[model samples]
Target: MTSVVITGKRYLTKPEEAEKFGPFERTYLAEGDSWMDSSAWNQGSLPEFLVRGFNRRGRSRLIVNISTSGHTLTKIVDMMNDELVWWLNQGTYDALLFSAGGNDFIDAARDAPPGQGLLFDMRGKPMPANGYDCVNPAALQRLVDYLNVNFAAIYQAVRSSGKNAATPIYLNAYDTPQARDAPAIRDLAGPWLYTAYTKNGIDPALWDQLTAGIFKDILHTITAWADGRSGVHVVPTSDLLDKAVPGSTGDSKDWVNEIHPNKSGWKKQVEAWLPLLS
Candidate 1:
């Protein structure tokens, strides 16, 4: 139960460090965005929680994490050409864990040029029935389709690798977040959802409904893609944790910021995902 997680750099520079823990029952190669990468704002992320949980269960697990904060799915795919391939081919990993799509959705929420972003300019449009109408259907579809293609590419890459051809691939969908002014770092990083909703002229009342609807669509689409696929698991996390209070500007309930969860929230999520890993 002395198992631990290490960064890809550590694994590369000191391969014997993992051996000190010795005789791990399961090893995982993980790559993703901020959810897997702990920063100054977030002390422990999903990968770290998974290691702790596995140790608690008396299962020895070592995770080689190669995730970077702020990376989009496109960037994740681009990484395949570099160090990701080396890890995939060199290790006898039990599974490949990925945490993505959140940043991609965040990027799409930007008010980019016409037809480039997910939100519609709701300025002069008639009032809609619900918050779902805040998002442009075609643009949303394009984002989902783009994510699907990239995920499929990652899947294919793992399958094509002779060493991990049969390794399980696990993906996690983010939980719904409140559209507020809570940034991981004040004035530096985010308040991502708040900016998007405000820029699109979406009413404050509709922010919660709209954010939930968007994540619901993403979860459903990703789950559908993984359906009937061999060795692919989509860990549904949309409703796992309590959402942040609507107008709070800092840590509230289970959320640390606009996107990331607090340690308690990560614990709940990891509990749900542990059975799948087992």
Candidate 2:
């Protein structure tokens, strides 16, 4: 059996997710040539924290990272097809750390024309204000549904393969970054997301719906749905907020963005997965 880190997008920002739980009885994945000198170690980049296990199990750890930026299940399968096939037949994974779904949310919300409505993104794309009806809510919902279907399909594929069908899978849910970063909203030059979206023009109600309602609900639903599966568990990233007071200065520093976690943030999330880690 092998230890593996199966993830996508922000989840696999680094190998620490798989290595933190190790003493390397027999680690598997290959390390990047400049692994020790990767840029993610820099501040403002991913934090230099443990992946998941720290004071728990210290054995031969093999981390096989199958993470990709902006990847959906369809995209990840295409990119890692050969690697996944080999890993499946080789039966090299015993413990697994799986995280995903952020890109699906990002894609659903990205269709908004630049500058119109509440812009919750930092990507340097052009902004435009299309009217309240300008955003297609139904299409977005359909996109989300499609994403969930793909997620289920991927999970089924993994379970039906030569690998252990009962191998525990953890579904990670993101916290409300906007709500979590409220202090930044109060101090930042503009209303952060709100100002950015209406920098062009958008309705106040629409902004609230986008930031407080839709964004949070998307994450909640994904986790709730994933949890219903027999062999899957939900691990929420918001548990750290237990320590982050409502009006604290450190909130901004806690997040890399609305979804991705900083090193310390990721550490907190990984903690929730420890019991599930086989």
- Which has the greatest TM-score? 1
Clashes of each: 0, 13
Every model's TM-score? 0.94, 0.61
lDDT of 2 by residue, 1-278 (tens): 22433232223476466556554554222111111112333222111232235334543445454443345555655544565444555554554344455545444454356623223332353333432333445655666677677677656756776754655555555555542233222343212343344443444435534554554655675676555677766665554632333333344455543334455665665565555443
Cα lDDT tens digits for candidate 1, 132-226: 78888898888888988998888888889999999998888878888899988556678887888777778787887899888888788778668
- Stretches of candidate 1 exceeding 4 Å from the true structure: 40-43, 111-116
What's the lDDT for candidate 2? 0.45
The deviation in Å at residue 64 for candidate 1 is: 0.3
Candidate 2 stretches greater than 4 Å from native: 1-39, 43-52, 55-60, 111-136, 179-200, 203-209, 224-228, 242-251
